[model samples]
Target: MLKLTDMTLHYGHSQILNGISMEARQGEVTCVMGTNGVGKTSLMKAISGTHPRSGGKLELNGEQLGVLPAHRMAWKGVAYVPQGREIFPLLTVRENLETGFSCLPVSEHFVPDEVFDLFPVLKQMQNRRGGDLSGGQQQQLAIARALITKPNLLLLDEPTEGIQPNIIQQIGEVIRHLRTTSRMAIVLVEQYFDFAYDLADRLVVLRRGEVMIKGTRDNLTRDQVLQAVSV
Candidate 1:
């Protein structure tokens, strides 16, 4: 559902992504893996329009897109759960979820029960301030808020980072359910090897801003990916 062709990005001449090309399909998880400083988050920013790409083409569904800003991208059905959760510390859980309404029509302003179903804890803590929640709870809140956008392409940058193991397993189950039930394309940037590999339908490994290996899980072995991303 999403395609990037020879995409490149930079921060005032210090290039981050170099001619990176990949595709993410509906009902599948495309996991982007790499070690630190390998431009994994930069790639997420470029696709989500948090940072504009310097060159290359971005296509959503089947339409070609230009260098649009984040809100515009959200309006086009791109929901980003950026690293660090980035929730409003002072806002209540419900309010933070409601913030997603900025991209939707007034007629569709109400939060759906399915969101609460996906993260049951969110329903219980709807009235609590975001800053009052635990790390795992906050991460659940972040993912839930992104789901509020009803995106066609979901970009999750390191959802497991800093999360406890049980919550990480919960998050994985949520991702699995999404892939099975919806046609949304999920592009996950993860450093947690086993979690990422187990969930990935396809893998794209990056090293120093370029794609080192890209293929289906069946075609690539665990050790092959491990070796590629390690170096």
Candidate 2:
């Protein structure tokens, strides 16, 4: 449901992404894997409108997008779960989720039961301050907050980083369940090879800010993908 053609981005005078092309389809996890300094997070920023693209085209559900800003993109159904899990430290869990209401209509202000269903812990700790939660709980809260926007395109950047193993498994289960039930296009920017590989329906490997290899899981084995990313 998301397509980026020849997508390019720059930082000051330096180019971080060059002629990159990728797509994410509904009910599928499109994992973008690469080593550090390969522009993975920059690509997410471009897609989520946190940073504007330098050139190329971005299309969502067949509609071409111009240089839109973050709020506009969020309103257009792009929910970004950033790498750092940027939850509000002082806000209560419920309040943190309510923050998503900014881009949504007034009638849709309430958090859905499915959100708490997907994250039962969020329901139990709705009144707790965001900073008081553990890292994993905060990560779950970040994803739940994004879901509060009712997005069609979910951009998740490194959800597994620094998370405990059990919580990582829970996050993976949530991602899989979302792909199965919501049918939203998910772009997972991840470096954890096993996690990405197990969950990815398609894989795109980036090197030096460009696509090095990309194909469906059926055509690419774990070893092949591992080799591509390890370089």
Candidate 3:
């Protein structure tokens, strides 16, 4: 459903992504795993249009998408749950979710009932300020807000980064359910090996912005995925 062909990016004279090429298919999770400074998040920024690529082809369902700003990409069905879970501190939980309404028409402005179904805690705290929530709750809110956009392509960067174990399990189940029930393509940038491996139908290993290993779970051994990010 999404493809990045021969993508390369640079910040100033320093190159980050090197001829990166990958794809994410509907009802499947395509995971990007790597050591730090390997441009995993940078690749995401390029695809999500948070940052433009210097060279390469990016296509969404065969429609060519030139490098545009993040909001433009959002309008085109690319929903990004960035690394830091950047929810507005002062905004109430409902307000934060409402922010996604900008990308929708007036008729679809309200948050979907499914969002509350996915996150019951969020529904309970609709009137509470965002800053009052715990990190795990905040993460759930972030993902819920992204889902509010009804994206065709979901770009999740470290959804389990600092989450508690129980919450991590809940998030995992949510990811799995999304893949099973929806026709959306997911590009997950994750360092937690087990978490990524569990949901990943396919994996792409990045080293210094280049793909070192790319394979389906059955084709790649678990030790190798662990070793690739052990640096």
Query: Model 1 segments beyond 4 Å from truth?
Result: none
Q: How do the residues 173-202 of candidate 1 rate in per-residue lDDT, one tens digit apiece?
A: 999999999979999999999999999999
Model 2 Cα lDDT, one tens digit per residue, 84-132: 9999989999999999999788999999999999999999999999999
RMSD of each: 0.6, 0.6, 0.9
lDDT (0-100) at residue 209 of candidate 3? 93
How many pairs of residues in model 1 come into backbone collision? 0
Name the 10 consecutive residues with the lowest summed lDDT in model 2.
Answer: 100-109
Q: Residue 200, candidate 2: how far off, in angstroms? A: 0.5
User: What's the lDDT of the predicted structure labeled candidate 3?
Assistant: 0.93
After TM-score superposition, the amount by which residue 7's alpha carbon in candidate 1 deviates from its true location, in angstroms, is 0.3
Question: Which has the better TM-score: candidate 2, or candidate 3?
Answer: 2
Residues 1-231, model 3: lDDT tens digits: 898899999999999999999989999999999988899999999999998899999999879988899999999999999999999989999999999999899999998888999899999999999999999999999999999999999999999998999999989988998999998999899988889998999999999999998888899998988887785
- Decoy 3 TM-score against native: 0.98
Error of 2 at 14 (Å): 0.4
Model 3 weakest lDDT span, ten residues long? 222-231
Pairs of residues clashing in candidate 1: none
